[model samples]
Target: MTKGRAALLVVAAIVFLTVGFVIGQMVQAAGAIPGTAGDPLVAQSYVEKIVGETVASLQTKLDEMQAKVDDLQEEVDALSGDTGTNKGSGKTTLPQSSNPPAQGKTVVVSGDSANIRTGPGTTYAKVTTLVKGDTATMVSEENGWYKITLQDGKEGWVANWLVEVK
Candidate 1:
């Protein structure tokens, strides 16, 4: 064939192949299901289902943690002599019985020096020290420890064995 005709035939053949490939791709895309090997896109329903499952799992974990916190709060209430009712105040309050000492009741340090802690235990952080003859107002007593308010209004716990209540 002549050069012109051969060139035209080659161009026509290329256009036909291109058209066929485009049509085949369109057909496959229309028939393929999302989230399948043939389709890269994921269905919205499938994504939502996975998210729902994850949320449910997280909620279960949160519920378990909340239960633990509630149990811990109950134990703290018992130890601190709280009535376990805040009257919707969301703040824990100590009962009157927890501070049975008469108002203005004081204690004198019997030892040379006594370490006053933040809590009613030696394992707690020490807040201050009281020397012999230093007196503190008694607030409460727990676990053989006396919770006292110092002259400076700071409250701390001291071993009951080291103090004489007056």
Candidate 2:
């Protein structure tokens, strides 16, 4: 054959092969083969179903958590309401004194010089001194002496004659 004709035939063959390759690629992308199960529609539906279920479950969990938070808020409100007027909790008033002397009851000093002793008697170590009108809590009273707790939480005894029950 002549050189020009042979060149033309080679060019035609190359074009045909390129066209066939392009067609093959298009067919593979279409996923039309039977039993291959790679259809775009089917894959999209599966992904959508899984995502929908996940979102629904998350919503349900959020609702349950909100319910628990609401319940806790109700309990807190109830507790706050009960604390305002409940006199039985010991936080409302001081204990009432029943006898002449009792611990934790407030009393006033009646003397100018009162010695606070370590124990409930005169022989114990003198802890401190209390001036007149110094109010203290009478812890106990024995033999005309009063065991008392000072304002600073110190425990001691004072002459009963120097303290008057208030």
TM-score for each of the candidates? 0.39, 0.38
Give the C-alpha lDDT of model 2.
0.67
Q: In candidate 2, what are the lDDT values of residues 54-133, reduced to their tens digit?
A: 65466446546655665565666577786435422321222333556656788787755566777654445668766668
lDDT of 1 by residue, 19-120 (tens): 999999999879868775456687766766666566546644654665566667677777878885742233233343444456468999885567788886
Model 1, residue 55: C-alpha shift (Å)? 58
lDDT for each candidate structure: 0.72, 0.67
lDDT of 1: 0.72
Stretches > 4 Å off in candidate 1: 1-103
Cα displacement (Å) at residue 15, model 2: 99
RMSD of each: 20.6, 29.2
